[model samples]
Target: MRTTVPPQEKLSLNVLPSEVWRWSAASIAQQIRLGSISCVEVLQAFHRRIDVVNPRLNAIVHEDREQSIGAARQLDGLHRQDSHARGILRGVPVTIKLNVDMAGEATTNGVPAYSRRVAPADSAVVTNLRCAEAVINGRTNVPPFSFRWFTEGPLYGRTLNPWSADITSGGSSGGASVSVATGMCAIAHGTDIAGSIRYPAYVNGVVGLRTTSGRIPAYHPTTAQRFYGLQSMSAQGPLARSVEDARLGLLAMLGADTRDSTWVNAILEHEDDAEPVRVALVDEIPNVVVSDEIKKALQQAAASLVEAGYVVERAQPPAIDQCVEIWQSIAMTESRFGMIAAVEETGDASIMRSVHNMAACAPSVDLGGYIKAIALRDELRRKWNEFLRAYPILLMPTSCHMPQPWGADLGTVDEMRELVAIQSPLIAVAALGLPGIHVPTGMSNGLPVGVQLVAESFRELRLLCTASVIEREAEAGSALNYTAS
Candidate 1:
């Protein structure tokens, strides 16, 4: 792994007593274990950061400072008693998305009507973070029902992109990305059904990992049974400022849970020989008008990988359009049966408009059609799996266009159709249950730009290794330059 100071750390170094907020989760954990810092001091630094920045960003919608401080005190006592009591993420301050279950907290999911729907117990992800001794500072915001790409609703208002308020802070993980980018947390937990995790990270200039569907067990104790779309497509993962920190967060969240039947015990890392690996570089889609900036980002990432001992070739996966269609068919139809009524009744205006536009873009499907789409999705997954067998890593654009305007998804149905075409890269990977990571390259025209890397299911280690290489190059001049303003 390459070691270099990230742009965020460079800025933090100039300030007194506030540098702790910018340290990576790995560094924070090690420092706490070595008795260099107490959990109370670490939590205090983040609390100060939240107070200074969160008012403008609106990233962390819910906070429990007293509870977090108490947890930190208990952790400090444990560390004093047993020298080996440190978990992998011990003393690391983190934020959980509001959509997940947290005991005594409302899983409002950005819906005003559900503000009173408190969770009786922690979700599996929260339980894993607590087991890892991570301090949950607060709950981040999301779109209502987490159904839109832009993060804004009646409940939490909006999460501004630290780089530019005019551009979106991509959802449904918008707050997760913003919180991590602005140093409010070392790591932020995010959930991705479509591009929720990856897109938010892309726009906010952070690293987001959309793990394989079953890599991290997920369940919500406060909600009803999950829809089929969410069950097969949604993934729980982490967003952080660096690839190593993201890996640390992932390890802390992985474990077996009886609540989620889809949880897998797959090996986390694959053995590597000394030979160079093949990487398929996908810079353009057949019918998609990929912006020049996006293509340039992909080329730069590919060049970095080639210099790091990987063979890069131009190749496109099979049936990408079909994959998008199948994704929309299954996801939209499932929502129609399971969530439309609730959304119409309780969702905010933004979600109501975006959901209707999305439904209009999807081809109407009956029960048999939905089932057939699910079957076809498996076939597409097999084809992509075969493609990935030859190419261990596939480099592509995170989005075909640059960061969009704040309310881009609330436009006409035809506009949403166009948006979907540009977002095919994100949809295809989610549809196939593959693992992908968004690594920021640098800034372009005052906004962050980045590339996406996809690997075979359960091959996150490969993605992380490759992402670190590109990230080192990004350290030269990346958007981590943005400080909380």
Candidate 2:
């Protein structure tokens, strides 16, 4: 078996303090557990990095440096009292998205009216992270109602892409992606209903995993109820620089909570069979104009998997166009019930325009039509599951085209329809409740480009393993290499 030393293992006692911020979460936790580095030192190193980089990117909108430092001190004391006191992610610095509940902090969701709506308690994901002994260093930004792909809003302003100003940072988890890419934190929490997590990671050149729905329990204490579309499709997952770090974050975040009725306790890993796995490569979609750059990236990823001893073949799954339409029909219909009204009332002009454009594209349906769409989703899932039985993995573009310029989402209804088509890859996976991840291939046109890997529900282990292979073969350099121009 091939092995490599953790990044921290290569550092000497006199190494530059700034370099500590670049270490992976696995490396940081391992070093902290070994007692060679103190939690205070790790937290302070990240604090300095945030101070220097966050002003330019606006990734982390809320921070409490003193509180994080105090927490680190407490963790250090516990580690001194007992050697086994370290959790899997002990002393690792993490950021939570602003839309999720963090006790005593506002679940702003990028609305000015809800700026004072402080959460009475932490959400399930937040509780799990705390239990794992990870330090919550800050909160990331989101679009208004977290409804747009661009991370600018009236509440916290815009989060700039570290690579280019003209390109979007990729929201509604844009802040999360930027924070991880720029070394503000080792791991960041994000949510995905459509392409929020994967899209941001693709554009920013980081790893974002959208776990199976209900894999990680989600609940916000401040909100009374969530629309069915949001409840069924939204997923909580981690964004990190490496697949190993994302796996560690996912493990720590998984736990049963009574608050979420949909939460399930499923086996995370399965024993590997003797036969090699097969990968289904999707380079193009019917009637969709996939960019040459993205198709080339997918072809490169397929080649990497083949080299890694996996069987790779060109194939397309069932009814991708139908999946996209069903997702829009159900989600848009449910949003009209209440979410649209709220957005219009509280959302800023950008989000409002984006939402209006999206609604315009969605097919208006009656209750019976909505129910039929729900039933059709099950049929699609059944077909997809049958397809996966033959090919355990699916490789495709994270988005049909490369990352677009900012304000693309705020374009006309016709433009928004085109944007939705481009995002079909992300939407189909989410709508069917499958596991998907974004792994960067390399740079093109001076911007990051990547491919998406997906597996059946509760098969996140497979996705992560495959992504690790692609990530290793590609060797796409760190997002930190790019200056925030």
Candidate 3:
């Protein structure tokens, strides 16, 4: 299904910090640090925005007005650290994907069954952000079991795209991306096991980062273990409206945590203008039908970057299909062990059964295969590293298809199978554990399009530079089509 984007929202230049929710995270941080706005003021700004837009969009499932306000209230004079005021994100209003934990909040993961079960403490991502003084405005939407590419809860129904209400905001992190896109939060935190971070960013016309695995330490309140494969594929990153916000979000979230053994040595050589980006325009790499609109956008972005003095080549990516299978073996095994256990324990198996049954397709490997998967995963890492020895960046469509409708069919049975196929492009890219950036480039039917930039480990600086160049080109051409309700 296609969607026509409505006109862009009427943003007031007067309130720069609160104007576009996409960059609001960084904007509010600056305001709070400069004392131009108090933490309470910034938090209240976000709260008011939620009240204004969420009912129409349904992007945020649960919100805490009092707690958000209270957090902001404590941010008064945080700039004066000598006076004992504390807040790293002092006054910054942020949203967490419902899949993650926040104290006293339910890690719903978009399921109705767990709505009443509250978390005892924050996830590591949340704790790190809080340590930096960010106020948790609310929990955003997710696909049921946090698996699909569309946000619909048997609990909350649907999360409509803010730019075009009929279309989706993209899933797993759909609600978070939508909330950030439409001024709900400055930035929203999202997880990337597959393409949760990048696809949503593409659909929402924002900046989303999929940091290399082990870069941003991931920890939930409940789990203490992450298997090697899961550790390799499982990484958490940030989604924001702007490149700098993405940079700041990554800086805030990347830290060592006890829960994840893989989270270590984040001493990345951060460089914005990292030489000529050896880029490959991998169009339809795995035979996925690349939409003409997306293809045009990719080609346009590549040409613009080339004109901007970067070396661009239309080459093939590392064996994305093989990488995907390796990733699937690991991901499905972990899913069965974790999600299936939860399903069986509950016995209230509706969506749970569907989730488990789907996971059953790629059951865990034997000890030998497990060892081989690890060996192969490492081989892929080295292969990508070697490829980057030549090319620094890769340009591609974040997804082969455009954004689906709000209540699209990515359900149980056929739905699960379809999503598994549909999500392949993102999963294929993500399986390699590289840093990919989704930069909003153009629009169609009032919705947004993004150019996906894949870079080697620690090449995020180069990716951001490419995005900055693309951003300038896009701005020089046309602004994003932000159709308001």
User: Against the hidden reference, what TM-scores do the models get?
Assistant: 0.95, 0.96, 0.87
TM-score of 3: 0.87
Superposition error at 422 for model 2 (Å):
0.6
RMSD of each: 3.1, 2.5, 5.8
lDDT of 2 by residue, 119-194 (tens): 9999999999999999999999999888788999998899999888889999899999999998999999999999
lDDT of 3 by residue, 401-462 (tens): 77776544435555554555555667866777778888887877666776788887766666
Cα lDDT, all candidates: 0.86, 0.88, 0.72
List the lowest-lDDT window of 10 residues for candidate 3.
Answer: 1-10
**What clash pairs does model 2 have?**
none
Residue pairs clashing in model 1 are: none
lDDT per residue as tens, model 1, 1-485:
32222212422223433479878887788778878789999999999888888898899999999999999999999999996755888889999999999999999998888999999999999999999999999899898888888998898899998888899999999999999998899999999888899999999889999999989988789888787666888898999989889988888899889888778888886556223589999988755899998888888888888888999999989988788898999999988886677789874677888899989989899989988998999899889999999998999988899999977888899899899988889988898888999999987887889999999998887788888889988842333345564
The TM-score of predicted model 1 comes to 0.95
Name the 10 consecutive residues with the lowest summed lDDT in model 2: 1-10
Model 1, C-alpha of 384: deviation from truth (Å): 0.5
lDDT value for model 2:
0.88
Worst 10 residues of 1 by lDDT: 3-12
